[model samples]
Target: MDVALVLIGLVGGVITALSPCILPVLPVIFLSGADRERRPYPVVAGLVLSFSLLTLLGAALLAALPLPPGTIRWAGLVALVLLGIGLIVPRFEAILEAPFARLPQARAGRDRGGFVLGLVLGTVYVPCAGPVLAAITIAGATGDIGAGTIALTAGFAVGTGLTLMVFALAGRAVSQRVAAFRRRQRAIRVASGVAVVLLALGLTFGVNVPNYATALDHEFQRLLPAHVPTGSDVPPALAECVGQALYTEPPDESQDCGPAPALTGITDWVGTPVTLAGLRGKVVLVDFWTFDCINCRHVIPHVEDWYAKYHAQGLEVIGVHTPEYSFEHEIAGVRRAVAREGITYPVAVDNDYGTWQAYGVQAWPSLFLVDAMGQVRHVAVGEGGYDETENLIRELLTTP
Candidate 1:
């Protein structure tokens, strides 16, 4: 383990143990407990185990096991949907009633310790970190079970634990105010149930909203300078697509979007297909990225915005998710990535780096611009070329 990474894990753990979002749930878990002293410990343990289990599951998914992203997302969405339906529909209320109603017969007054508590808490407590945690876990599911999984699990546990510990400290206050908050609790339960349903529905269908991404891509173009260089140095036919900019020099060998790789598979979340060949009549910008890449995280918002603005104008934006880790392979993680980032364009997953190698991509955010003739145009290695790229896209879209 890298000593620095381990230290980072420890810090993440401590902070998670103290976060505000998770702290409030501790009291509820305690109140759900039949025993008093055993309250916080069990809940805390459950929450910890949940994080550990989910993290481990994530690591496993990254291994590219047969499990597909749609399956997991659908399963989780089903669970949340069922829970929500139980809350909203009186006829379906029996589902929620079963847990509370069967509590007496199920436990037989037996006390649940840390592990059991942890399981229950994890099962019930829906942390705001769901999407991020789910993405990490999905990534972990890809490669390296030994050190990578352990480190990721440890980091996740610490992050969640740090937020939960504060709840442990406030458990007593939470217990005392139970009665005064009963009405509020009921309302919360209803809201939570609805939220789960809504989230599931969004995951199932609403993942295609494209407003944010379109806006950001536009901002990138608008930021360009007034004058763009172009002339005899540039191809007469391709000059318009270059937007008055000359081919300053050959594209960097490292930034080259290697020969277009064979299309092994395609999963369309937005049903938009802007292939390398399809863009032969216009300019194309291919974004090589993964949902979990911290750098890609910042760039996606802009990518989405750019796609919406320039796509109709003949700029084809194809986001290739060449995941760096295993968890990124999960379709659910990809779907969440698209939804969370508000990406409306088409994305292809290169979990195996089949496409990554095809493009010879080596960075989180490598952009490849292909001219109207289908040859590589310009390439940007890292961040901070939004305006230049957008100008190129605009020029390409406007070309005859």
Candidate 2:
């Protein structure tokens, strides 16, 4: 295993925990073990195990398995629903905890079946990662798993697990501290149960409340590193390998990635249809995103700002709306998202993922800056490159 990549992955995972992409799942992670008697370690352990394995093998496994579309997601929702019910009903909760009652380790990790709860959450958990996770997902789906991939995946899981541990512990602390809450464990359990059920239902229906926690995410991105800074001691080849994935560097415009791929197989359009070829002689920002992704939601405002600020000056931002969930495939949802976000730029819905594959999109909230000459100038994957992207846009607009 390449230790450097693992380190990079570790860092990537920590930042992702702080990113807007994980915002939606933070509450679930926080409340997973909020009960005074439940331990957070086992839940986190289960979460890490599930996320790492699934990130590496989930796509290929899902495609190869005979299960119907969205089966795993549905099953996960059902599991959470049952777990929630177990919390709201004491007899059911006792029945659920009966199996883990005697085993010591289970007592610790599966206290109130926390491990199982984590496992269910992990199946549905979608956290945005730079090239670290994208590479793992591709490697997993394409059967190209290797030591480096495995190490990076492991490191990312560990980093994310660390943060999740903090949230879980915090929840436990808060639950124990307030005498009012401590005295009413049943009520606390009911509240936690209701949260779990709501989360499950939201995922079941692709219901997402955008702009949920932007300020917190802003602080995270503002303070954390987004990519490996320039002139690090890392090997040049290694840096280039993960360049598409970003590591937290001060943006440099000297990058020459390649030409932008043709935008194809877009089944619908929210504002209008646009092609890379037709968009020539213009500074184009192609944002690959889905409506339901939290990170994408966070990134949209910046895209809107840029489009509003630069559209008159030869800037064209095309939101290539891709689907991560089954419901995002519908145009009606896309329209609502666009309107809600107050986005006036064109949106291309690539339901078939043809455009996604065309650009080798590794994550939602990915952006490619194309110069008027129709050459790809810059790529920002997984949020947090606004200053650099904006500066580059200015340079491109003024230069050509």
- Candidate topping lDDT: 2
| Clash numbers, per candidate | 42, 8
Q: Model 2: which residue pairs collide?
A: 131-245, 226-247, 226-248, 227-247, 227-248, 227-249, 228-247, 228-248
For model 2, residues 255-332, the per-residue Cα lDDT tens digits are 666666788788999887778899889999989887767778778989999999989989999999876654355687
Best by TM-score: 2
Candidate 1 TM-score versus the reference:
0.50
RMSD of each: 11.3, 5.8
Query: In lDDT terms, how accurate is model 2?
Result: 0.72
For residue 375, what is the lDDT in candidate 1?
65
lDDT (Cα, tens digit) per residue for candidate 1, span 234-272: 333333323322112223222223344333445443446
The local lDDT score (0 to 100) that residue 202 gets in candidate 2 is 73
